[model samples]
Target: MTGEPFKLGDRERDEIKWSCGAGLGLLTRYAPGDFTVTLRLQPENEKRDRLDLGLLRKPQEDSDIGEGHETWVPLIKNVTSFEISYFDPNANTWLPRWPGAQLPRLVKVKVGRSDTAVPWEAIIPLRRTPY
Candidate 1:
């Protein structure tokens, strides 16, 4: 709510509240140590884009995701559009900006690829919440 604005890569929004914390993955129960995964969209060309995943070993206390030794891995390529939405349980609605300390109940990712005519979408539910 404060600062310049919330920016996801080049796009910016002033309504979303950004927080700093660590989150567990699907292998958190089987594995150990803090695991954080950050997804970002990088432009491949003027009309296309690519999705990149950043892996962090330690927890970050600040808003910046570049605190520890992170690895950038390409997850998908030839992405024409990438959109993320957070489901707010209290509001019973999906929002573009996930604003709060607690994690969203469901995270939705929609991707449009150049190779395919139909867009791909996925709705992932988070098992853990800060509350």
Candidate 2:
């Protein structure tokens, strides 16, 4: 789960600092469903050194109407430096952020710890279809 030929930019370094500072991160997840889920790292205490990974769910109907509720469900704890990237098939490149109607060919997630050198990462493939 760890190891990589990875590079860090100003943006990435800032993100790492922000995540560690607030002990929070936002992770996007796409699926064939009526709702959307975003995974987030939230601080477990006021110290902001420890965090919990959680999912925030919101129904499409609510988002469209602008009058609905969201639910937060925690998954894991003591997480840090969570980052994500999307691979655009059209552009044939990886992007730091995804904001398109079509699904990206691949989704890459990276998680790091303050105590470790290389971060843990995963590249997940998605259907090449438009939503």
Candidate 3:
């Protein structure tokens, strides 16, 4: 399960790089639990990427204390990036994430260009009304 759409900015791009460099992707899942969101990010690029799968959800009566209404708990974010790269301010080198996300806001396919510094199928799981 993926998400709707969430744009990526310099801040987000940087976050996903240093934090989850390898599995640098954001995927959402509409599971049958509290948080139905999963942000994929791999701090390293490897063959068998790792998964740091997490869940995102609003606040519930049994929810944690400090957590806000909209929060994401990383679950599968340890996967290695087979193609994506960060925006290097040093050599001016740059790469883009693969189209494995569920971003419906992007221009479907990123035409031309050898790389993209942003997410493709960006996952933005729709928030459900807490029961």
lDDT of 1 by residue, 49-79 (tens): 4533222233333345554544344566655
Best by lDDT: 2
Estimate candidate 1's alpha-carbon lDDT, on a 0 to 1 scale: 0.51
Off by over 4 Å in 3: 1-51, 60-65, 68-78, 81-131
Better of 1 and 2 by TM-score: 2
lDDT of each: 0.51, 0.55, 0.32
lDDT tens per residue, model 3, 1-131: 22223233321221121111112232333333333233333233345534333434442333456645655555434422222233323344433442334322221221111145543443222333133
Choose 1 or 3, whichever is better by TM-score: 1
Identify the leading candidate in terms of TM-score.
2
Off by over 4 Å in 1: 1-36, 43-68, 128-131
Worst lDDT run of 10 residues, candidate 1, spans 12-21
How would the candidate models be sorted by lDDT, starting from the highest?
Answer: 2, 1, 3
Clash list (residue pairs), candidate 1: none
